[model samples]
Target chain A: MLKHLTAAIALLATPLAAQDFSEGSQARSWNLYAEIPAKFEAKVVDLVCEFTGDCPADCGAGKRQMGLLRTADDVLILAMKNSQPAFTGAAVELQPYCNQVITVDGLMLDDPDLGARNVYLVQSIVPPGETDKIKANTWTKVWAKEHPEAKGKGPWFRRDPSIKEIIATEGYLGLGLEIDEAFIAENF
Target chain B: MRHFTLSLLAGLALSSPGLAAEGTRIQVSGEIIDTWCYYSGVMGGPDAVVGSAHHTCALWCSAGGIPVGLLAEDGTVYMVLKVGDDTQTAGGDTLLRMAAHTVEADGMLYERDGLRYIVVSDVVSDLDITNKNHEDYGNVPGFSIPDPNK
Candidate 1:
């Protein structure tokens, strides 16, 4: 599975860039992503509920995995991420649209090797009859509200006090202070 | 240009009538890894980001919505689509619970564009974070954990 992906796609305009194709062992054209561009209409559904009948009233309240049940092919495309510089899932954005049909404009990635046929990264979404496209940035808003203290000039992860606290308490190796100290002594 | 390929996940077929991703069933064992950091070379080299040292960050990354990849024993990252009763792949709660843990799973495999995808039917056994590489490489990137000093 690791062999199937490369960091080459990280050079895209958006932090969401996913793949790169190096042809003939020489430098070739750089693509938008290792994914396909996709746009379509679908009903938003919680994947767990859709697959296991464990339907929640709020689709896990943006905490569960949300998918778009495509109207075109009835395909359940996992709406993987939002259009954020840092990694953010699309759950928050799509949860509100649960069971409601909406138009999606985004990128699609699939891995047949692991059986994930088509995974989606939503760049934008459109509610029924709405001409304007909603950028898949809902997670950012939620993050800001949740971590107003984390607001800063860099990626949210770096400024996130919660993450910083975790790292500080656990140490970078995630080992308690003792093991980390031993590792420090052994290495430096 | 984006290439159109056939998608076949285990236990997960396109609900489309008479149409579905034709996947092959198989049993595989490996560690659930963060494909973004592993491939992106962000947190550290591939070796630094697996097993115990990377476990904490792995949970954070998975929760953050980076696609979860199963770093197989042979060093392959099988992109996990759906596993067992989990409704969604990647950032799903179940995937979060399984973060960095190694497991032997029965599932279907599909290949397209030189990539492998999986839809796990059953997780036979979970080894639970067995890589334990922090002894060799301490907290790779040294950033996954913040510096208490600073």
Candidate 2:
């Protein structure tokens, strides 16, 4: 109870200290898989520079993995993926915010056991007192623009030409035509 | 000197949901695999998805932001969050290079959601794609090899 109270106080105080990410909250009811709705302040940084001191401008031009240098405890939390259906990374959304401290709204996937301390899935960027929210949806928009001919109603991965070609060439089992044929003939 | 405090830089307990102030150091040997395809089973069953067969596809997945997994000898898949010097959960150059290769790793292992995740500090030794299953599966998903004519 004291822990929960402290966390509640931390939430209200906003001193930018160690956030008890695991303290009971609304994320407990989030429908998304293992997502804890997170709204925290941090400075976005390029992981490459953080790791190897190889600092490139523009956060490696959204090519390198970006992480949040949490204002509290100075913990670096990786924003692994965005709120896209496919495993589209959070780079595009976080690129512009690089080297800047800002308030972010997203889902924090925590797996203490796996040591996935704070792998955030950025949904929208909402800086403090800012009404304009930057939503993480650049990937699909770019995909739609690029694949004009194959544009349709479905997940992008399914209609992906390369994936379709691969599946067609190797069959669903990915074990060559002969094996797939034999397996299907016997099983189905 | 810990760039990312992912659980523990050396050995410190993290919080609940990731680690509860207790960390485990592990030395595991396994094949680096595309976790997305492995779990999704889109290409094939578990058997055909690893080794020399899935190398090309694995590379594509790694580049396309699908985090790679270390399929240990003990049949446990550990999500390779950050590797050696190249920090990043996924889509890093190191991950792309390590794709489909078998290696021995020493790192902090975290057990969560009945799965495993590791931020490897050192890739002890890389065996360099030694599975040799391509002969059996013959380029698991043939489209992975782009057509020269195109």
Candidate 3:
């Protein structure tokens, strides 16, 4: 799913700089993370591993069991034990990938010296159904429909063809509003 | 050029504000793991040549070749020298082609919603690990087996 940004819709230009973990320290180490209490299991399910990609057979050599847990704030902690991807220092570590949730025993990132390790410990199991706080398809489609001109040459923003096909084929109209048809015809 | 790539990512963030925050935006950059220039989706789809067999590619890469991308539980990163769905590189500082089972890299980790990912701008992997370990490992039930031999 994609949504285009229009010149008219002035979005907040916030360049969230890359987070710096050099100063801070982890409250715990990756090994210590195992002590956190949570259910751990290994299963091969066809999850959209990375949103819209094929699920390979081995789940990648680093593919370990996935962890899930309901947090105190109704937020779920979904953690995995895999060789950390290439975006962090953990990638250099030689740890067998194991996707499991670690129960945080009062682990806090604010504590000095813990660093990413603190994050590892604090992040327990993630619960199901919590990830989709913002539905990707609806948001992108609606945005594109509203600003049709923002298609193609815009940011990786556009309506998902699958969703549009469903809506068009099923004859399921959203809100019965035709405010955006002309907009699409004029721009897209 | 570096600034341009960074700017592109930033611009994408503004338009698709949420993706930049969460690990939703998938940025694959690396040696082409397995190019399916005529890749047909498992079930079915346009034959635009998609890439697949990530697990097999990873395993082969571990043996001794620069395979594809590093897929972590959160996100993934690849070492791409050029950009094109069908285009491939064999081996050169600029034009390169190689497969691998292992790589060493550093990057930043990002998380959004419940997904976690790492966005890697720098990566270094050995291109000598593409062995036949793939055959040693059988396919898991109900999942597509990676064509490691490829």
Q: Which candidate is the best by lDDT?
A: 1
Tally clashing residue pairs in candidate 3: 60
What is the lDDT, from 0 to 100, of the residue B110 in candidate 3?
50
Q: After superposing candidate 1, which stretches have Cα over 4 Å from the reference? A: A1-33, A111-116, A148-154, A159-169, A178-188, B1-30, B35-49, B52-57, B65-98, B103-128, B132-150
TM-score of chain B for predicted candidate 2: 0.82
Ranking by lDDT: 1, 2, 3
Please write out the lDDT profile of model 1 over residues A33-58, one tens digit for every residue.
34556777789976555544556567
For TM-score, candidate 1 versus 3, the one ahead is 1
Residue pairs clashing in model 2 are A111-B17, A111-B18, A112-B17, A112-B18, A112-B19, A113-B18, A113-B110, A113-B111, A114-B110, B13-B21
Instruction: Give all candidates' CA lDDT scores.
Output: 0.67, 0.65, 0.27
Q: True contacts preserved, each candidate?
A: 0.21, 0.07, 0.00
Evaluated on the second chain alone, the candidates' TM-scores are: 0.83, 0.82, 0.30
Q: Which candidate should be chosen as best, given DockQ against the real structure?
A: 1
How high is the lDDT of residue B39 in model 2?
55
Model 1, position A35: C-alpha lDDT score? 54
Q: Candidates sorted by DockQ, descending order?
A: 1, 2, 3
Q: Tell me the tens digit of each residue's lDDT in model 3 across B69-137.
A: 342222233322122321122111121222322334444445533333343434455433333222232
Q: For model 3, how does the per-residue alpha-carbon lDDT over A1-188 read when each residue is reduced to its tens digit?
A: 13456533434443222233223222234333223322222222212233223233333332221222323222322222222221111111111222222222212222122112212222222223233121111223333554565477522211334323322432111111242233223323
- Return the TM-scores of chain A for each candidate in numbered order: 0.71, 0.69, 0.21
